[model samples]
Target: MRNSRIPFVKYLIELLIVAFGVFLGIMISTYQNNNRTEKNIKKSIGFIHRELKSNSQKLDKAIAYHYKLKSSFDSIKKELPSDLAMENYYTQQAFRHNKVPHWTGLGMASMDNIAFESAKISGIFQEMDIEEVQAISRAYSYFDSYTKFSENLMEKLLAIDSNSKVADIIVIFEVLGSDIIITEQRVKEEIDKINSQLENINK
Candidate 1:
């Protein structure tokens, strides 16, 4: 009876040892996976940070260029002649170097979104905090809106005839320039918000 009890006790001890080993293995694997995920998150955030910075710089340049262009248009409008024929002639002189000058050489806010798109494709957003994801998404939506707006404006500019009257062309430029400025300002606001959020995240 004593010998039989010893064998049973040995079997029980072996089973307990196996269970402990399995638990330890699971713990180690979980730790490694978590570490890897943290690293990936940091990498993604870094890429996004750089991309946003680049876009902000580009926007600044675009804003400056558009401001100058608007000023030029305003100046031309102020000095335009009252007579239709004279006004057309003056407009022609104003744009003598380039008809459709504003559209032909417009300052475009060609912002990039490759980093953001890549993050989405990689499913990184799933790991990000909901609010953070939302902030980034909101910023990108503004970028997209601005892009579409520019495209439509370009189409309108291209549709204008080369012989269109100066008054007509000036009106188009004034309106479109005003819209572009407003849109750029809104985009700038979103960029500021996203930058603020990024600062908090880094902290």
Candidate 2:
């Protein structure tokens, strides 16, 4: 009977050992996966930060251009009726040749979204805080809306009859100038806020 009992004890020990080994393996796997996820989160954040930096620079130029355009429009609008009369051929011709392009369609630079796209596609956004995700989403939404507005404005300007009255053209220019002024300030603030958030994360 003692010999039989000895065999049963040995079997129990083997079963316990196998269970322990499986548990250890599971723990290691979980730890490795968590570490990899942490690294991915950090990498994704860094990528976003770099992309934002490039976007911020683009916005800087855009803001400056818009401001310049606004200034030009304001100056031209003041002289509108007098200039439209075309009493002096040379002066009228000079203004037409020099300022026509400024009043026409100006191209807007597209914002970069490589990192944002990648993060969304690869599930990196899942690792980010809900608030961070919302903030980034909101920023890009504004960018998209602004871009669409610009495109629509260009289309409307282009669609205008070449023989349209100077007063009508001036109205469009004034409207565009107003939009640019508002949009430029909003973009500046958004970029500055995003940059600040990035700096905080780095810290």
Candidate 3:
């Protein structure tokens, strides 16, 4: 009876050792995986930050261009006569002498979204804090809205007739210029928000 008990005890000890080894292996693998994920998240955030910075610079230039264009359009409108025939004659002279701004002169923002889109596609947002994700999403939505607005404005400008009276063209330009000004203000606000958020994350 004593010999049989000793063999059964040895078998139980071996089984316990095998279980311990398996648990240790699993713990090591989990640690390595978590470390890798953390590094990836940081790298992706860096890319996104750079992309945003580039976009902010682009917006700054666009804002300046739009302001100048608005001023020029306003001044030209004041110089033109209200009568359609006189306005058309002055418009022709202005075009011939390079006094008029072309419809294609307006600056387009063309904001960058590749980094943000890539991160979204790769599921990196899933790992981010919910608030961080929401803030970034909001910023990109502003970018989309601005792009669409600029495109539509350009389309309207392009559709104008070359023979249109100076008064009529100036009216359209003034209206569109006001919209551009409003959009620029909103974009500036978003840029400020983005800069603040970036500062917080960097800290």
Candidate 4:
């Protein structure tokens, strides 16, 4: 038979105290972690929504240019022997007068959206919103098509030769006008979706 220095009652009490301490510490740590995660998610959503706003404005400007070109095309169709003046007007209208894309704003916007999405996905996964996703994903494609239309329009303008055909002018009006409408609709839908998600996050 072996005898311990401590009493059995005292040993049992000490073990219980240690287990309680460990459990309390765990509860505190877990609560803190949950709070921090919630804050981060909210922050991400806010940042991304701001980015989406800026990007939408830039795209909207492009859409305005498209509308202007369509108008120019309409009025000029009355005249014949399309010349330098008319072509130049159309080119300037089409390229937005050489207005460049807002890269800095766009970069910030992309980063914000990505961060927001990451934080969001980490928590309860919202059902995949692929419809809006598809529209949003098409931004670059819209730009690419419109850019080509712009360049080609510019070329036709430069080569006016004072004897341009009606067909040449009509081509630009057809392509650019149509593309702008599609892109504008897509951008609006994407903006609405982003706004809705951000509101949910904030609430």
lDDT of 1 by residue, 83-171 (tens): 55335433456454144335346677898899899999998889889988898898888899999988977776566665666555555
TM-score of each: 0.85, 0.81, 0.82, 0.56
After TM-score superposition, the amount by which residue 159's alpha carbon in candidate 4 deviates from its true location, in angstroms, is 14
On lDDT, the leading prediction is 1
Error in Å for residue 114 of model 1? 1.0
Q: What is the C-alpha lDDT of each candidate?
A: 0.76, 0.71, 0.73, 0.53
- lDDT string for model 2 (103-136, tens) is 4346465778888899899997887789888877
Q: Please identify which of the two predictions, 2 or 4, would achieve the higher TM-score against the true structure.
A: 2
Model 2 / residue 124 / CA error / Å? 1.4
Which tens-of-lDDT digit does each residue in 1-203 have in candidate 4?
Answer: 13564577678899999999999999999989878766765665565557566656766666666666656655554543545334544434443322323211111111124534563566522332455334434443444454554565567656754465445545555565576457565755666565666666567
Give every collision pair in model 4: none
CA lDDT, candidate 1, residue 66? 80
Error at 34, model 2, angstroms: 1.3
Off by over 4 Å in 3: 85-104, 162-168
Q: Candidate 1: list runs displaced more than 4 Å.
A: 83-104, 162-168
Supply the TM-score for candidate 1. 0.85
Clash count for candidate 4 is 0
Worst 10 residues of 4 by lDDT: 103-112
